[model samples]
Target: MQAKHQLATPAKVLESYRSPLNGARLQQEKVENLALSEQIDQFIYAYLQFNSKYQNATADGKIPHPTKAKLLSQQRNKLDTELETLCSRSSSIFDQKERGKTLVMAVDEYLLTFLQLSFVGQRSPNTLEKMIGRKKRLLEFLTYKFNIIDLSLDKLQYQFIDQYYTFLLVQKNVMENTARNRCNV
Candidate 1:
């Protein structure tokens, strides 16, 4: 199924279109197709084919809705991040030579992707559970505290680390030592 993007009026478009940078980044790594959903693969293919479509479409200087604009920005950032990862990885499941291989890959490669991963399943259920939990907390801290919906790991600063630490200690009621330990984890 195709993802539905809303149509906007000319008045809702931006003046002087420009491509935006990704809000988050992933480390360099090649991945198997089994690790990626076909929807994401298709989205990447389609987005690549029309990299400038968003710029062209936003001709005026406004957005039809704030939420729609936010969503668009998120999607654009995700595309940038994945493309950057593919570039840095030097290979892809889509690469002919990579058709059949057992490569050592980090779980972060897929976890950090814009796509959602279920909290259940995985080789070690506890690891996956903790990952999902920490991710949720980090996202909540960024969004609720900083009003930052699109988290740019590349732009993460000490302020974020501090805020997260405080959040752990105060909001989550984790001991200071335990919060530090969790951060270490």
Candidate 2:
């Protein structure tokens, strides 16, 4: 993990983004910032444990047990998916409007497209409004957790489902029952 340039920054993220930096009144902002820091910590810890397990399995130049090898493969795939989900979220935000990148639809943009197809005409005005509000919050959480500001579903991973669940509980400070209701949306 330390050998990779990308992985090197994981530790710094937690420090830089931690809440209560100056002990000031922006307490809400600081609390909200916890999501990204926790994401980095979780990613690095998971990667290191996975790496160590893989290394120990083959340390003696012996073939891993079939079950161990299969488990390692599954872990490797999960880590790859997590890394891709994190890295792909980082794009040159500045180059887009200048380079005609705005013309290309992102996952967020597709939200409206799907809404039209699924709910716009079929649902009542109040129902459509609630649906849009839920989706907006979901997209906002995606941006917070993954640094994925655009509507890009390709950057999403199964891991994010759990991350978003935690984000609601932690950063959003939703009540247990309220979180269940919000998450179900």
Give me the runs in candidate 2 sitting further than 4 Å from their true place: 1-121
Superposed Cα deviation of residue 159, candidate 1 (Å): 2.1
lDDT, residue 38, model 1: 34
TM, every model: 0.39, 0.33
Clashing pairs in 2: 107-151, 108-151
Model 1 vs. true fold: TM? 0.39
Residue-level lDDT of model 2, residues 74-144, one tens digit each, is: 98787777755643432332124432222113322333333333322453434434544555567678679
Instruction: lDDT for model 2, please.
Output: 0.54
lDDT (Cα, 0-100) at 9 in candidate 1: 46
What are the C-alpha RMSDs, in order, of all predicted structures?
21.5, 22.2
Q: Residue 77 CA error for candidate 1 (Å)?
A: 34
Candidate 1 clashes between residue pairs 3 or more apart in a chain or in different chains: 12-62, 13-60, 13-61, 14-60, 15-60, 23-152
**Tens-digit per-residue lDDT, 51-163, candidate 1:** 34544456686443667567677776776676566545524543444233221122234443422222111244334445545655765676778785344344657776777
